[model samples]
Target: MLSSLALALSCLLIISPNTSAAPNSVPAAGQSIPLIRRAQPERTVAEWESWAKNEREALTAKYGGNIEKRSTGTNLMTNQNADSSYFGTVAIGTPPISFNVILDTGSSDLWVADQACTTGCSKVQLFNDLSSSTFHNLSEPFSIQYGSGAAVGTLGQDVVQMAGFSVPNQIFGAVTQASSGLLNPPVSGLLGLGWQSIASSKASPFWQTLASSGLWTDPVMAFQLTRFVNATNVNTEEPGGSFTMGFLNSSLYTGTIDYQALPTTPSYWILPMKSLTVQGNSITIPSGSSSYSAIDTGTTLVGGPSSIIQSIFAQIPGSQPGTGSWQGYWTYPCGTAVNVAISFGGPSWPISPADFQLTKLTSSQCVGAFFELNTGGSAPNWIIGDTFLKNVYSVFRFTPAAVGFAALSNTAVAMNGVNAPAPSPTIGSVSASATAGTGGGSNAASHRWSVSCASLVGGIVVAVGAAWM
Candidate 1:
């Protein structure tokens, strides 16, 4: 496809042990970056729709299905320092309490320090500290992790105010062993916009909390990231974008919102597959198999059963099947012509070359780059990251909502020009991040327009405009 471009979370959890992880061993290749850069595009509502529609519903009804509906939101985009990695703070309660937070859609489980686990978890940002005069920790601290290694903390009652809404005495994550990166993001904690397990807790969560509290009649959340690439004058804190959560308000976008159904939630958006194609050619991958695919905003990369990934990679010319530790992830001759495509409960959609490129750790030589994830996984697990999200306009809904997913016309990204990866560390090995590289904090410039071309099966060469209307 492109390069072994890995989503920050995929690289971290698969590699880290604190969070539940697949066994580790020698690493293999990752996704690749696109060899060519296409002309950019001017984004509009219409174009985004075509890229993420159901062109294969009748064909893949057995694979799974898609959904779209109006939803709501609550800001979890933690405010950051204007120039540093630290998260800005807010005072709370009579004693004054402060904590860092990272806005995450991949994994859920909002952990904050609990009053009880005072020992081992000190390194982590604690919530119960009464240093701020306004701080207060409730007697109950509850913590949960879904295999992505997690720590425990007391569940206290307190109000967390951000953006607009204030979640009062909301039970959040006070994860242990992860105050600083390595399962703990640099921020004090994380927000679960991604709904795999209602984030951390399987039950009582922000959705339940809000719905129960009657703050919002419906739970709907959608993200609008800035563009990739950076611009010097950036304000990561209030620097740019904003996500809205509440019942879908038509006033948000000037375009139309598509709705899809999400019948089950073993995986939040489990849509069936119609076919698998390489360079536009149909391949013999199982489409009707009992195995289903789940769309996760929490997971940065798409992981699935070994057979599925193996088949896709095997078909790639010159690509080889990695063993032991590295599987599912793929690699091919850097210059050799490569074209990878995907099907999300519908027709095969090609994976962009940029999506394939894992990372160009080196500009001089591209050897260090990895191809998404290789082995780390055991059974059929698909974690779709930027490769997929960039291709579709995704929206998430929580609890008793009629819509399971919301489809946007386009993910028009506008970056103020800031990169999410921490600046190079000079003093010491920077504390490890739970995930590597930033998730799609910014949308691809391609949203404005796609340029350039590559020959696919039958030499059916195709090229996209830098901008689509």
Candidate 2:
């Protein structure tokens, strides 16, 4: 059964053992996996704002307040502070025990609760390494520092199967100890879909491993995030969307696919954003802004510079800055149709008004999906999440190291009642100079970065850490 993480972040996958395919055999030219969009229970505007505030605060603290410090020369770490709404399935081991895991593009390490984790993992499925004939203990310690706690365990290798594909001897964490509320029922761990450069474990991610084994026609993956906030059905769990591997699904998108080149030494699927506008008026980007954006599927909301977020909200009449627990957030008239659009050196894509409205306050005002996030001078200025992603079809290509976006097909758009105009013809490439300052930091190779999962999974704000050996 599908389950939702109250305030947690990232995507999930359900794995079923596929023993038919050989260990290193390619299954098909293109494979598609169904995704389940876990609908968050309706919340008051105050609660939503509070979550947003805590998320930003946790992220700021994770990077030492100023993101530039972490980017000075240190390897940029994977830290997330957002909510997850989409999930799929996957399996590990020889006989393959199935588990629900988050598919996070922002991170690059795969981990699951070990059968020995009796603390916070009680409610979730555990990986029984001893039961798998192919399991091999690496004896290396593995730890993931969360906002409120950590998942500590050891490294091991076993066959991991997903979407009819199998990668033998995949390295992953087997968490023997976990803090409270880290892994909930139906959501056991995470499947990082990023490059190995950012992986804390220094192991290649699942997709990268598959690509290296010659398992696909194209080294790319695409996502189409479904919406439920304003849908008529409004169920707790529904067919969220589709994740396509190897080849693009033409039926899921329309028009031409616009591609943007990543950084010279890219880690995340980050690219330069050309422009942003609200209600037809352009919002001036602050000078000295990194102007780069990480296309993160794990993040639930769109986070950017405080000034730019405030400017966008200012365009809507009756918009007001949130106060107290809702600080760093803004609210607008519930009836207002906020039309926002963004570009990445190509045709501008519009975000649906329904997707932009987060939650209702006082029956008149509604919280917005965009919030204040100042990532200092050198880090990515924006974390583009499902808020904007749900409006279009996104593609992450590894061969040429670029990200692509296309307008959603009419069928996909109808799911959320989104009525957007056709995009204009594609434009020339945008300058990548704005992203030059990113990916820097002190060589903290000996130090492991810790993130607060408390803010990410639940509403709490607690500090947690673990030793890596």
Candidate 3:
């Protein structure tokens, strides 16, 4: 989901953070960091649907609706929790205070709870600027809204180290107050990997700063997002996979990488998607439908236009639109293998059926991974998330402004096993019916895009909160 906050807050006032110092040392290219996958306990189908609703609402607020034209904008799965986010540990300040933060490619901004955050920072580790001799306060305010909650703070600069690489004078928000929903224990903040143009803070993201400082050998970052829903053993937390900077790891993928050129003046990793197919049948996108798609690593499920999503489920037997709280969603037979794929001016990459079945709903019905989205205007119509990303090795290249995808290697595929024949109660289930539409399309209409600006500073703000959406 591209945060509407990016677009709505583009004209935010800016106070440049000092970037005078060089890194302690230039690390070699291809530095890899292991990602931690945190899974919440399994919830009922209704609970999962509710979570999905919130996720979509947050996205709607971020991208949908009539965004204020003041200025700029920009821009998981489960469990076995039905909602999992990937994290990588990064240290801020002089002596290096480490915090496990989400590696989000959706928006551009890096932030963590400040020592002064008394509102919802009690449980998580806070960044104590007083202890770090190198910390500098930019004296600029910052605030960002998320679907679950919002965080408010001030801009600050310090040394940031991750995976053996150190970037000095990195500007980030030191949150003073936040909603409890944005605070997931042990998961302190987020590291934005999107373009600087869409950054609410109007500051270079950590990765871009590292590249500009001549520390990166190739100016590329790649991800191998692992899965666990179909694993033989389920756990609350597990190894999500790898995040490599400066170079791509050949061992994680096979064959030539299919690189899709991004739009000029790109914000998110927006690209042209030629078509979408379900069970090898191409689904027709309406005439006014958006042709551009955003390869968002920060989102959980795949979201498309409402009518297009409805067309997708129509091809599956026994498929039905969600009724009450599950509106804007579709469900099908749990045992049905729904093969889906999408092309980006190259060979169509197939999505595993296991990932398509988000979670089981009943003895016979299972929720599909695709959801409906209506962004009102010409934003990217398709928002691709982990449901399709986990099947490939994704690389975000800066120079050419392109996103590359390659087939996952056997070793990478073995991390998550195939989906079981039927639903497992221990996995998760909810109460729902595959009947005629009741609260279906109407619920989606209710979400017809809106923006919620939680807080702002110096005319600039960026989301450094949770990446659960």
Return the top candidate by TM-score.
3
**Each model's TM-score, in the order given?**
0.55, 0.70, 0.71
lDDT of 3 by residue, 36-152 (tens): 348989899999998997787678788865422111000011222333566667778878877867777876778899888878777778999999999988887777655446667
lDDT of 2 at 444: 19
Question: Residue 121 of model 1: what lDDT?
Answer: 47
Question: Candidate 2, which ten residues in sequence have the lowest lDDT sum?
Answer: 69-78
lDDT of 1: 0.39
Per-residue lDDT of 101 in model 2: 66
Query: What is the C-alpha local distance difference test score of each model?
Result: 0.39, 0.64, 0.67
Query: RMSD in Å for candidate 3, one decimal?
Result: 24.0
User: Candidate 1 deviates by what RMSD?
Assistant: 27.1
